[model samples]
Target: MGLTVVAGMLVVVGIDVTAVQLARTQLWDAADSAALDAADRVDEDRVYAEGLHERVPVARAGVAEIAGRHLAEERRPHLVRSWSLGSRTGSPDGESAVVEVVGRVDLPIVGGVAEAFGGGVTVTVVSRARSQVR
Candidate 1:
């Protein structure tokens, strides 16, 4: 009986861990897409005035807005019970777009248990993209 109980618990843990990994991967994909989209959207005014000699310039507000719109419009994974854009979702430099996505994973069995301790399993993914013109 003891062995059976231990085996079952282990199996549950394995499943929950797999779910977390899947959720993290999905979040990462979404963040990457958002970053790429934002990077492609250069400041048109800057480009028109300065011209992109080497790299395109990105505005922090524009990058955040674009990334937020992409994340809001993009399809989310079912494993991610809930998610939100992180504060780091903006351009670190004038030429790059950085996106951070934070999500809570839905565990099949131990979700409640984990939540009771510290709000369940949460995952964060960050992605960056840059555009250059030659």
Candidate 2:
């Protein structure tokens, strides 16, 4: 009986760990896709006229729009907590931007045990793309 109980607990732990890792990986892929999409649509005229400093907000908005679209399509049930965008100026070579999207993933295993913890697992993903001034 004791050995069986231990084995069962171990299995539960393994499942939880796997779920967390999978959730994190999915978030990262979504972020990457969103960042690339936004980077591809960057307005060169705006960046050039306003300069990298002032263009950060514009680029950030682009990224957030793309990221939110993706998240809504893929993870609608998981509420997005925050979405942030950052611009890397004076990179010696050129300008670059980064988009970070964070949200809570309702892990099956965790949700099953929500009475103990009270909530689900939180996952965060950050993706960066270099601005192509063309």
Candidate 3:
């Protein structure tokens, strides 16, 4: 009986592990896609300064707005809890958009209890990407 119980527990934990990893991947996907979409619409028709520098023309408002729109569309049904925009900045690093996505993965069987106790593990993922200028 003890061995059977241990095996069953292991199986459950294993499934949880897989679910967690997939959630992480999905979070990354959401970030990447939103960043890409924001970058795409950032600025397609714009002129750059006359200088020897690597700089990107940024459309800050549109970038954040577009990113939020994409996140709203891409939010997963169960895995995602809530998501929001973080910061949109441009510097030597790059003209980037930072998207933060949060989700919860309830533990197998005990998910409800775990959440009730202290809330299930909340995963907050922040993704960043640079925009290109034309």
Candidate 4:
């Protein structure tokens, strides 16, 4: 009986950890995708003017929209808490842009084993990429 209880507890812990890791992974992937998309649209001619028009905010919004649509289609419920796009500043050779995305996903174990220890769980992911403008 003692061993059985221990095994069951271990299983529960494993499941919770796995869930959290998976959530974090998904967040990172989304961030990467968003960053790349925005970087690709960067306008180099008028770095200040055109770049502002094709800023990280615009890219972040686009990514969020696409991610939301994807989650909905997969029947997953996740909310984006915050999203930010870093500035476009570099040398004359080239420029790099950064996009940061943050999201919160409700885990299945939140009310069960997870709440027993503390509260719910929230995952944060950040990704950065550098691309040369034409």
Candidate 5:
């Protein structure tokens, strides 16, 4: 009976851990899509079509604007308690956008346990996508 109880407890832990992983993965996917969308906006497609330079630099304001639209869309379905965009900055190579996003995962089982501890896990992710004029 003792062994069975221990095994059952371990199984709950495993399931909770897996739920956390899945929630984190979903947040990551949202970040990836948002970053890519932002990067695409910052890209110099017109210049590329005109056979111009290879690297397209994204402006600071543009990054925020483009990333804002994508992030808004990303928030619709995910049951994050709350979310924030830490930063949207250009890469060192002057041809990419990096989006840093932080979201709270709200899985009931995990949330219940975390509530006992005063908090749930926050999943933070950074996603980058290159913007090439060529």
Candidate 6:
């Protein structure tokens, strides 16, 4: 009986950990997709006026808007309780799009009690993509 109880507890813990990891990976995928989408969105006004430089110029506003839209539109994993745009979602060098996505994951077994107490693990992921004139 003791060993059976221990094994069952271990299984529950393993499932919880796996759920959190899966949520993190899904969040990362979202960030990567958002970054890729933002990378292609160059500042058209700057490009038209100054011509294409060695690297495509990515505007901060464009990156933020694209990332935000992607996050809003894309479907997220059920394990993820909620997701929001991180502050670092922008173009750092005017050439690359950096996207940061943040979310909380709820464990399978303990999630109910923890959520009732307003507790959950936070996950954050950052992804970057750049475009070149070539």
Estimated TM-score per prediction? 0.90, 0.66, 0.71, 0.57, 0.78, 0.90
Q: What is candidate 3's lDDT per residue for 1-134, written digit by digit as tens?
A: 99999999898878777777777788778877877776555343443344323445445566667877887787474654555555432222335665666666555555666776885566667776775434
Q: Rate the local accuracy (lDDT) of all candidates.
A: 0.87, 0.57, 0.63, 0.50, 0.68, 0.91
lDDT of 6 by residue, 66-107 (tens): 899999999988989899889998998888999999998888
Residue lDDT tens for model 2, 10-77: 99879877877776776677777766665655555666777655223234445556655655666433
TM-score of 6: 0.90
Off by over 4 Å in 6: none
lDDT of 4 at 8: 90
Alpha-carbon deviation at 99 in model 1, angstroms = 0.2
Q: What is the lDDT of residue 4 in candidate 3?
A: 100
Summarize candidate 5's per-residue lDDT along 34-113 as a digit string, tens digits: 77776766445545565446756555456656666777876543556777676544444546778777877666555676
The candidates, ranked best first by TM-score, are 1, 6, 5, 3, 2, 4
The per-prediction CA RMSD against the true structure, in angstroms, equals 1.6, 5.6, 3.6, 6.9, 3.5, 1.6
Residue range 63-102, candidate 1, lDDT tens digits: 8899889988988899787878899988877899999999
Q: Which model is ahead, 1 or 6, in terms of lDDT? A: 6
Pairs that collide in candidate 6 are none
Q: Count the backbone clashes (under 3 Å) in each candidate.
A: 0, 0, 0, 0, 0, 0
Q: What shift in Å separates residue 119 of candidate 2 from its native position after superposition?
A: 1.6
> Best lDDT goes to which candidate?
6
Candidate 2 C-alpha error for residue 84, in Å: 9.6
